[model samples]
Target: MPAADALPIPVGAIVALFLAAFPIFWCAILWLIAGMGWRRLANAYPANSDPPDSADRIRFATLALGASVRSANYSGSINAWLAPSGLWLRPILPFRPFHAMVFIPWAHVRSVASERRMLMKLVRVALGGDVPDLVLSGRLAQAVLDRTKAKKR
Candidate 1:
């Protein structure tokens, strides 16, 4: 009895498969972002214009979305800007698809509270209306609160 030879996959076939799957993957990401409440937030506070030059930029920040305890955690992929007018948030380039940049004004921030979770100090900022609260690191949250207080004065 003779053994049959194995056929290798062509490089063109692999590239074609990836090309075909790209759009489907992108759509799935859009759906996931919507599920994470990003779509709702974007509708409420879309960033039509660019953030000001004076805004303080914070990279590799963490964020929590949704109202439930089992919310979506975007760890170390968020780029936040603390401007006098409001807080600007957007995901990094790779995760930016279907996630629009949003600007939540200081007035919308109802309250800011700090809490210790495990070893990390977390700050939760409650916003008005139906949007989810934003959870950030303690230091960053303090900066946001300070900015709001300064704006008031």
Candidate 2:
């Protein structure tokens, strides 16, 4: 094939290109929506929330976020609250807040349990929502559940 040999691509090729690209395009949109939606929820919460009372401070990472809470690339460990009422999963960047923050109520939690995850214990909390579950560290999850007096299953 010479430098200027190829003419305009065939219509079939164009259609195929679009078909292949659409999935990625749609995925990006959905991801943006999920992140923004959670960000809005986070901002809606009182930023001046009373300082964690008997709160178990933990290094929390938003492993995922969205209506589905799919797996993701979470970075920057931040201080989070596993309150007597809910779980605040988000980074505490002084100025740059994560788009997918979380605050989950205990009443909406269907179960609280733990299992081995690699070298650490992973506490799985089943919730009642579009994203019905979260995996946090055992130490933090246990402390929060104990304080909230939420039943475990």
What TM-score does prediction 2 earn? 0.50
lDDT of 2: 0.55
Off by over 4 Å in 1: 1-5, 8-11, 67-70, 145-153
Candidate 2 per-residue lDDT, tens place, 1-153, comes to: 556866588789999999999877766754564464445445444244543678666764433232243443243354567666666666555313344455666676677666775696556666544453555554565665565554443
Query: Which one wins on lDDT?
Result: 1
Residue-by-residue lDDT tens digits, candidate 1, 1-153: 444664377688989999999989987976786667777788899998878999999887888885376677778888888886888999888778888999888878888777787898778888868788888774566677677667768
Q: What is the lDDT of residue 100 in candidate 1?
A: 90
Q: What is the C-alpha RMSD of each candidate to the true structure, in Å?
A: 2.8, 8.7
Off by more than 4 A, model 2: 1-54, 60-70, 73-76, 94-101, 145-153
